[model samples]
Target: MELHNVDLNLLVVFDHLLRLRTVSGAAKALGLSQPAVSNALARLRRIFDDDLFVRSAKGMLPTPLAQELAEPVSYALEALQNALNRKVSFDPRHSDRDFRLAMTDIGEIHFIPRLMGTLRELAPGVSVATVRNTAVNLAEEMSQGKVDLAVGHLPELTSEFFQRRLFRQRYVCMFRPGHALDKRTIRLRDFLEADHVVVTAAGTGHARADEILARQGVQRRIRLRVPHFAALADIVASTDLIATVTHKFAERSAKYFGLRYVKHPVDLPEIQINLFWHSRYHRDPANQWLRTQVFDLFSE
Candidate 1:
């Protein structure tokens, strides 16, 4: 395809289709009629000489060629958007922008409340949405701009993304104030014997706590598993289940939910929570401002 003959608008359609996966979904996302989106997709297919997307039980699955083009197309559209909106300054007080964040339940519990309060004071019209973090293809999701920012202990983050260390957190043992273990400091032996409430957001599989225990040739009996920190904390506060959670979360819950915490028996590694964004948005003025605000709020 000649550069002069290629219609740039098709790139926007392609990006939308890649994200939404269905023609109707893409049309809705782009605010275009289905016929219009279909026409654009047809043009894109002819130019690329690929079907691009094939119908499947799980909606429109992208062909390998489409998958290969996804990131570049998204990046190009983002660049074009930035270029066209170069004069627009992000005035949080007046702008009605929605910032989407990918974070763990712990992050939502400890950070979002304070962050939203700050936003209320500084950027009243701005909104926030949180997506749960999963242990799969996080970099790809960030690259596609499905999430504006991601905050967690993401060991899988690629160097292609830009990241900032938000804060370092230690783990603590949590239980109801009057649980059997409340009167004494927890020991490694006690931890191994007690029933634990494990927060496995991604699923019931390997977790940091389990890995630490495995290193010592000890395993805790996980009586319950939950998907979010909030749920784990709630169960620990109301029941006899003990949970190991970030110190930030434990402390916050202690203050808010009348929960109690004690030092864990084993020396668990300190978890470093970082904020990540796609490199494509690293220099974006609005994103930069928001990132700075988030870092400042959380670091404090």
Candidate 2:
């Protein structure tokens, strides 16, 4: 019962014995010799004053005392293992880590394919999960480590977070290729006269496109309002509606969607896309590796 009398190795031996139920099995599990496992068990018996496991024809069966200590010992050992891994260096080539990212729908379209390709080549064992930045309590989720990283133009992730700029992109007006306004330069009159499909992507900086135009006293004939950028291409491709979106997204999606994009007439400022992480994970080896991969892959 003395605080400093117990050997930590004995607990390791005891835990393996309870699970494997044999001295030889415990020794193999712990990479120790059978005699070493037996010696540790003997010390454990002296410390606890009980025969922890009894030999039998079937296998080594645990005594009631061993059964009582089994759950707590396993939990303690697992907790210690997690603590060590948190401070240890991360090896992406061999790590089977699952990381969660916060992004908009446009981000999923523009970032996932390239990101996944890079990960498949560099860290085959690592996996990814994505959550929309509009999720409830997103800030709190990142703070408590539920979310690993947030990528895009997220002005909300300001304080208590560290961010690195990946790139800056301007908004461009996109429409079907053969539409009436297919000229190289779009006039302000033509832009305002055309029916528009506005993306009200709340909780994202993309929404600023409409705000910037409105402040400049430029208003387009609103034909549709969608919540995400996913359907914008298909809708604009099949109709005469114009959609203003980030240049990177427009450039990537134009070919597949069969749409054409031109510079905005209202002079919208470029939005800087950033990679953000909670301050708590700023020094984590795994997080640092992930951040570096993203920056190298996309930063301009």
Candidate 3:
């Protein structure tokens, strides 16, 4: 409990271990030996009088006490790091920082190509990795530094996160180019009567289209229900199924899939897609750089 008596280096090991959930991973990330990380963890357990993490087949699972300490410990470390490195310049062209992001499949398809193009031209040494937004605890992952940024309309990432609006997106009805409903003007009756490919992109704002329609007593003759947008273009391109998707996604994939999209006949609220990051990283130089690039490149 005495601050002066505790070693600061152990906290670094603890942070890495919590983020990676494995001693070997933590050691590799910290440039230390596995034994050193294990020894640091042992010391941490003795100091806290609790087994902070328990080894299991699933990796080092955090105990309740560790979970309780996660945020404050992470926040303190981030603050300390920012304070210590406030004046250190970040040379993106020379620095090799790996940024992890959380994104949906559509976001990866829509954003990665252009993002990589920009990165290759400016920050060639920097690497980027993406995980599904719904795959992990996004808030906890960002808080612990597992994911650096999450791009999408993720409503659950509020409270502890900071976000900047990127653009307002609306839904569009997409289908094969020569489909019967390909006319410039689409009627609601034709839309509702046609076979639809419903995309259940759960855990994202995109899924609300169906809910909104249902609330208005509008029903589509759904011929298929898919969980992701990755294959929607292919399915809709070959079938008579019309899909309701975000305008950007529909526009981006139309050329490749030989598809056409029209304005949704039924009215629906537009969704705001945003760039999100943990508030603790607000002052971190590298985090600031990455967020600035995303805002500059993607915002309308």
Candidate 4:
């Protein structure tokens, strides 16, 4: 209970436990073993005079006291980490630091190669790690400095985080070569009649394109639903289901999958792909350098 006796590192373990809600999961996230996480949990319980988290059928359930402690602990840790980061000057060329990013598979497809190419030329000592586990709360991830940059359209990321609209992408419907609808522009009538495959990249069944379609009172028959865009091309190529995807990805499918892409008939709103970072690192020189690299690469 004494502030002087508490190890600041224990707070990090407590924070991860709250976020993941499981000792094993927190251990994996923090790169620690299960025994280590269990020991940390025991220490946290002794410090708080509470069970902190209880094992349940679902997962580790946080006690009321633990719930109360989560926010303030996260904030204090982030602030301290931010102050410490600012004290050291970042030299990209010589600093062997790990730069982490949270991005979707689509963002990996679009950005990683060229970005890494540039990094090799400019900052060879910098290593990159991509985090694809969408289950983690992104706002918490960024605020805690676990993630440096997040790529994609996440409307949920607002207020505390700083966001930059990297680019906007238009929708295109794709089908295999020699399909009945492959030759020309698809009309709204054809679009509605087609059996469609929807890509729910965020695991939210509804997409921005679908919202636009609903506004227009047009409901296409959804035949298949996939979790990622990368899985769509093969499914579309092999099956009769047509998928509406971004033009950039559709172009790749056309060339690699032997599929054909056409403009979607209904006026679908362009999807905004953004880059997000925590405001805590807004003035950090290394973060600023990384931000500049992203903008300069895709600013067009």
Quick one: best lDDT, which candidate? Answer: 3
| Alpha carbon lDDT at 254, candidate 2 | 75
C-alpha lDDT of candidate 3 relative to the true structure: 0.90
Write one digit per residue (lDDT tens) for candidate 3, span 22-133: 9999999999999999999999999999999998999999999999989988999999999998785678999899999899989999889999999999999999999999
- Cα lDDT, model 1, residue 153: 81
- Candidate 1 global lDDT: 0.81
In candidate 3, which residue pairs get closer than 3 Å at backbone N, Cα or C atoms, i.e. clash? none
The 0-to-1 C-alpha lDDT of every candidate, in the order given, reads 0.81, 0.88, 0.90, 0.84
Residues 83-173 of candidate 4: C-alpha lDDT, one tens digit per residue: 9887756788897878898877777777888999999999999989998737678889888888888877787888888988788888888
**What digit string (tens of lDDT, one per residue) describes model 1 on residues 218-258?**
77787887766656666777788888777887888888889
| Backbone N/Cα/C clashes per model | 0, 0, 0, 0
What TM-score, computed on C-alpha atoms, does each candidate reach? 0.68, 0.71, 0.71, 0.66
Stretches off by above 4 angstroms in model 3 are 1-86
For candidate 2, write residues 81-182 as lDDT tens digits: 899887568998999999999999899998889999999998999999999988758889999999999998888888899999999998888889899888
| Candidate 2 local distance difference test against the native | 0.88
